[model samples]
Target chain A: MTALAPPRLPTILPLGLARGALELRRFFRSRETVVFTFALPTVLLVLLGSVFGDHAEAQGVTSSQVLAAGMIAAGIMSTTFVSLGTDIAGDRDDGTLKRLRGTPMPAAAYFIGKVVLVAVTTVAQIVVMLTVAVAMFDLSLPDTAGDWLTFAWVFALGVVGCSLLGIAISSLARTARSASAVTQLPYLALQFISGVFVNPITALPTGLVVTASFFPVKWMAQGFRSVFLPDSMAAYEPAGTWELDRVALVLGAWCVIGLVLCLTTFRWRRGQDG
Target chain B: MTDAAISVRGLRKRYRGSRRPAVDGVDLDVARGEVVALLGPNGAGKTTTVEILEGHRDRDDGEVAVLGTDPADGGRTWRARIGVVTQSATDLLELTPAEAVRHFARYYPDPRDPDEVLELVGLADAPRAVVKLSGGQRRRLDVALGIVGRPELLFLDEPTTGFDPQARRDFWRLVRALAAEGTTILLTTHYLEEAEVLADRLTVITDGVVVAEGSPATLAGRQSRPALVGWLEDGRPRTEATATPSALVAALGQHFGGEVPGLSVRRPSLEDVYLELLSAAAPEPALATAGGAR
Candidate 1:
């Protein structure tokens, strides 16, 4: 007689990956998130680059390369801060998180799936944006592998820090519409003062520069500039120094602060006591 | 024989800033393979009690054991043994029905075949896209997901709340099949007909307490209550409420010395008993507690 088959054990990776892929598909299918994450960044990058390319010295940069670096930083900002913030708040408001909490799936597994999807989408956005900058706008690549490595690490850290902050902010929004409005303010204001546009240190008041530096936007842009621009490029700046070490410290601080806030305030249910 | 499917005592929960409790001192028990329904009106603590038992919410003071473990501290094993069908349907728009079911099945140690569950829920023909399914079909998919894990005890929170008549009957068939297969079920619904047809026993809760509990016919001693006999007499409507409907019918026949005109007999139905229970449990709306309502 033939023997019976042995019992099978559950495996979680394929399941996690499948879940992440579906979430990514859902994200892309939503026209609002797509326009904000993909089209909006491309449009903003092009519009800002063209408007100020010829007037570099007046904008505190000798070349367009500095502006390109800042714009790439802006793209990272939008991915981690704006897109993730609104998405978390929307899920909380719609009872999706409450529903998921009832299921048997591990909570960590769900978060890992979200992070995986974010990684894939964020990388794609970076590549598409950089390709457009290089081919259309004559932007140059980083001179060495070390520069690319630095860019990748900074990008990863920036995504984590901003996404955590986004999750934290989601706890404050009462509804999806309010979440959208509340999250956009940071994205717009940070992009302006973090030197994505004209240098805020020169154009804005000193107090604003000092205040914006405490945030992740300025450090991310400074770190991006450390990779793309030449070593002597720091001489032409308002800060007047590269301050590579300071960029690491400031971004590191933002990452810690964001994580703490997320852990403390992130909620699975919509109402305060639900 | 020693294994009770579910047990709870003194289950209490209160929302912040709420003066009254949602689930206050509720005691419940379900034997192995028994199908029990919790029948109550809106604002009853049925959802809160079920959620607490599912380990999704905390209770203030309770001794609860589901599948032989305290739900408040039950970990992965306890969760794997329980299946919960929530009120909201799956809103994952990108995944197909088949894909969603398979994804959820992986979360359990032992899961049923995805195709078999799909067929059971009558979604075999429409497993491609969840976005394409009709309302009934979507609810069927929800059931499929809830049961694909082959849970020992299943909690269905208002499962048929939005179903049409035919769909509701179809869902009853599914519930019966699962119960026959020895899957213990605990359901909550607004449909009295459903409870009358499906539940072996039921408990009626109001204002965070049980006012009545028994078999459908026996609750509030309804089977022994007076029945109504009505007919047309002298072109006018005539009626009497009596303990013996047949006796009243026979008396009418003797008085007329023939069949009574427009003879009809009616008894207190499950809905009647349910309404009476609600009214008796709380005489005024002031007794209606806050939290866990709509």
Candidate 2:
């Protein structure tokens, strides 16, 4: 027998990135999935903003600009929560998870791959939303480095939290066919009460605003508005100021919660053996 | 036992809410560099046994040491030493065979070159997405991925289910080449011919237990089974079963005073031996009547 050296298992990070690259390639190849998933936020921005933009402008900010900012947050959630939930469910149904279980790749690497896939798709959503806002809605890019820094942190927390959440809920779907309903319903409901769908955060009932306050969607919307809308709109917020610190706290806490749920609920197999 | 690449003792698993254990008590071992074929009827615990050995499922009771490590707690290093090809692996959709193989190649420390692995599996030039490949091509792709890590032991579960005649023969050659390289293989297959062609020994399982285990030629005393002797006499056919067919044939030749007219002799084939074993080992009268699934 030839003396064979023990083969090395790749470290988590590079393997994770490689998995991430593969995920991105697969995600884009299904052209309809890309078009439909990406089109939702952009279409909402144009149609909703056009109908609501004209005189809804208050304190030097048009409704389109306000709506566009919040859409970036909603758009990120769409890509992270809904897209990932469906993607993971699809992976389970199509036997991706089973095959990966046999490989030397770690479970954390698989999560990292999903995160990477979400990060890329989320960035694409942000870019599309930003371009539309600039070209059509008269929304300007943040001028100061500090303002841009807020965008970065908010983007980071939002993506990580929602991606983790998507991973957690993906287990609830028994089949990929049902994943759409399992993912879409919760986030769709959150957007409405979180003030992404409904205009003027205070127009909703006090109880509804309080309920939305406990979730990440409201905080994410609040953070994005702080970046994209003028400073004066903070006065129009229910709290009469952008609670950026609380926004960071709530989103960060969700990231931890999401990770915990993922650790507890993920499954590699969906069917009976033998 | 020390030299065994895979060893199991009293392995048993019962699925929740099921009346019977899927694997009642399976004791199997594959020595280093040996090709062992597991043969059984459907729902006969063949998959259950292999899955337990692969560490893909938990056994209710038993001992399993795959590559000398308890599969239940086998770490990443242990996983790197083994290759598993299961029937349920249907992922890797958009990438071409080349792309998929190259990507999987990254996870191993000393994986075979992606191009060479692809070529060995006869998919070196498959340019379309994996989702577009035929069933046979996909099975070959599965083999390519299974061997990419240069694993010391390979567990193949129904690897040739969708393979055509040519593809099956080609795959048999591949298995032989891998065996010659000293890779211990424990393969589950329904094809008796496949077992005869590739396995050093054959194990026949039924209803979650092994009924017989031996080299292909001697399994269930196949070589010792009575052989049939036949000849034409006065334009009428005559036949008889004899433990010593050669002596019987020679006597018949003497009776004919020259080559006995249209004489023939035949021994029980592997399939006949296997069927007899299954019937003998059947736990119920109904199952014995049901016969072997093949």
| Among all candidates shown, the one with the greatest DockQ | 2
Clashing pairs in 1: none
Model 2 ranges with Cα > 4 A deviation: A1-7, A271-274, B228-265, B283-294
Chain A only TM-scores, each candidate in turn: 0.89, 0.95
Relative to the real complex, the DockQ score for model 2 comes to 0.58
Q: Model 1's A-chain: what TM-score?
A: 0.89
Off by over 4 Å in 1: A1-15, A58-64, A236-238, B234-236, B285-294
Q: Judged by DockQ cut-offs, is candidate 1 incorrect, acceptable, medium or high? A: acceptable
lDDT of 2 at B115: 96
| Per-residue lDDT of A223 in model 1 | 81
TM-score (C-alpha) between model 2 and the true structure: 0.91
Model 1 complex DockQ against the native: 0.45
Q: Residues B1-294, candidate 2, lDDT per residue (tens digit)?
A: 669898899988888988977788889988999999999999889988888888888989988998898988987787888888989567888899999999888888888889998888889889899999988889888888888988899989999997789989998988888899999999999999999999999988898998899999999888788998989999999989899999998899889999898898999889878877777777466764575462
Which 10 residues in a row give candidate 1 chain B its minimum summed lDDT?
B285-294
Write down the lDDT of every candidate, Cα atoms only. Answer: 0.79, 0.88
